[model samples]
Target: MTNATAPLDFIRPEVDRALQRFVDRRRTAFDDPDLAAVLGTVRDFLAGGKRLRPAFCYWGWRAAGGADDPGVISAASALELLQASALVHDDVMDSSDMRRGMPSAHRRFEKLHVDSGWHGSAVQFGEGAAILVGNLLLIWSGELWRNSGLPAESLASAQPVFDHMLTELMNGQYLDLLAQAHGENSFESARRVALFKSGKYSVEHPLRLGMILAAQSREAWIDQVCAGYGQNVGIAFQLRDDVLGVFGDPAETGKPAGDDLREGKRTMLIARTLELASPAQAQSVRALVGDPKLDAEGVATLRTVIEDTGALASAEELITTYVKEAVAVLDAAPIEAEAREALKALAIAATTRRN
Candidate 1:
């Protein structure tokens, strides 16, 4: 199960296979034709993703002395299902058109509505469909975790961490919605939202999940070390996401160039820009950055202001600080050498990747 040469090479394909079999069985059990389309949507949504949470969970287990068991991988793969639920609901909330270079689940439902000549409002139907599909994914995620074929005791040990991980994700997402609604853009607020909504779910909890599944050590301090590393790396990961939302290439990012700006996201980048930009520049940015119909020229102007104010550099520096903090934790933790190296690689990838 353990491949010291390439820690993740065996994981990704095995995880994908596990997901395929899980979904196929579900598809078989739920045979309603109307349910069929929603199941299909959920399947497709789960098909393509970076699978970061599962990766972290796998390594965390390894670091905690869990062997390379397909059951561990299957349990870890449950994170992807939960992630799909989050993303689908998020796209619905954001009213996004695309995800990973294709129509978002809600948008696809909208098209289905229009194509089929449904009675009710297409937009409403799309949103409803998105919500239903998201709920289904969440349910299936729990199913995978509970029935992963891991030992009963291991599943029991991991349950609390798993439950809290999702609860934090939901709370964080709500905080994000509030930040947008209130038009809040302070760095503190942004960080709080990022920590709960993304940092914990994406990194912290997943690592903790793996650690719990291992049930190797009941010591409290070991859990702290894992959490510390996960939290810092999670912050760095979210920081990278915020930076990419504004500056990443649409082709690579699979999002509109100024999607975050248009969505009025109160990210660190925007908060820093507000702090550093000249009064007039700040005023102009405030007026246009959040407009739903923000244009290319508007995005260009905001980009210029962001660059001139050095907000981008500041954000990058913050990311570096978090990454360093995470590395320090890894260096001191009692992890296997190979597992430590894999965890370090995950941290680097989270902070530095463009998309």
Candidate 2:
């Protein structure tokens, strides 16, 4: 391994440029009056995202000895489009009002409805519009992937990964909904969601897709490395997110603190806290766990309870453990030393980042 500032530099500009071109093409091709508004909303949602998945895809391809070609860049950009579609829908499902420092897509549409004095339920209108827009992005993503100009076999090899990624995302969402509804919150259950819903698609699958696109012959090894890497980074990423949902600054994370608590997210932190709490502490946490009206003081108290019960430290320790494991996987991957070093840095950055 050699010195590298970050893997981000390799793909950020490429993905951005590709996305801009795609968006421009959409605008020119679609003459609908709502096109501008839709594009603007999409642009806003995509503006400040870390673009981590696309970067992973790009590096995965490069690490597999892929050339810096237009097809590979476009394929990575398509992954970003798919990610945007998922987020737009995910925010709506979560009833989240903010994302990436702006109103969520549904919220933005709802505001537009109210501001224009449009008839009917502004909330429904916003949600409906956002759903349609998300579907459109999904379609565009598919089109981009199909037209990426890779060799026929390479394109064919990459298709299953794309399909499987979407399936895992949907399954994860379903698991999340079920856990919330049934109050079946447990550490094991949360870990299941984290691995399937987030870890594989967000980190592992993207890397695998990139490798496939690069025509790697050792597909099984690539899968193993990416899975190992993804599991560690993905779980760590969500654990960090669980922490941020409680302790992160609203301005930095673009969401109010304790939002997860309010939503009663069955995250590992919450699960561990519940497990570790005393009878009195357990009752206190259970009483407030799913309450939407939990006040700032109540939220503060819950935070203290979690910390005092050692859940916070436990989650942090898990994050540290996973990050180290991911680094080890990166070290073992049969890639150029430079690529391995970049991936190690990425794993550290992804796990340790505050937002």
Best by lDDT: 1
lDDT of 1 at 86: 95
1-355: candidate 1 lDDT, tens digit per residue:
3332244465678789999999888676668777777877877777777778888899988888888888888899999999999999999988888888778999999999999998989999999999988998899899999989899998888888888888888998899999888884788888889999999889988888888789744468557876789889998899899889988998888788999899888887888888888889889888987799999999999899998999999998998899888889989888878778888888887787767
User: What is the lDDT of every predicted structure here?
Assistant: 0.85, 0.83
Which candidate wins on TM-score?
A: 1
lDDT of 2: 0.83
- Backbone steric clashes in candidate 1, count: 0
- For each candidate in turn, the TM-score is 0.95, 0.95
| TM-score, model 2 to reference | 0.95
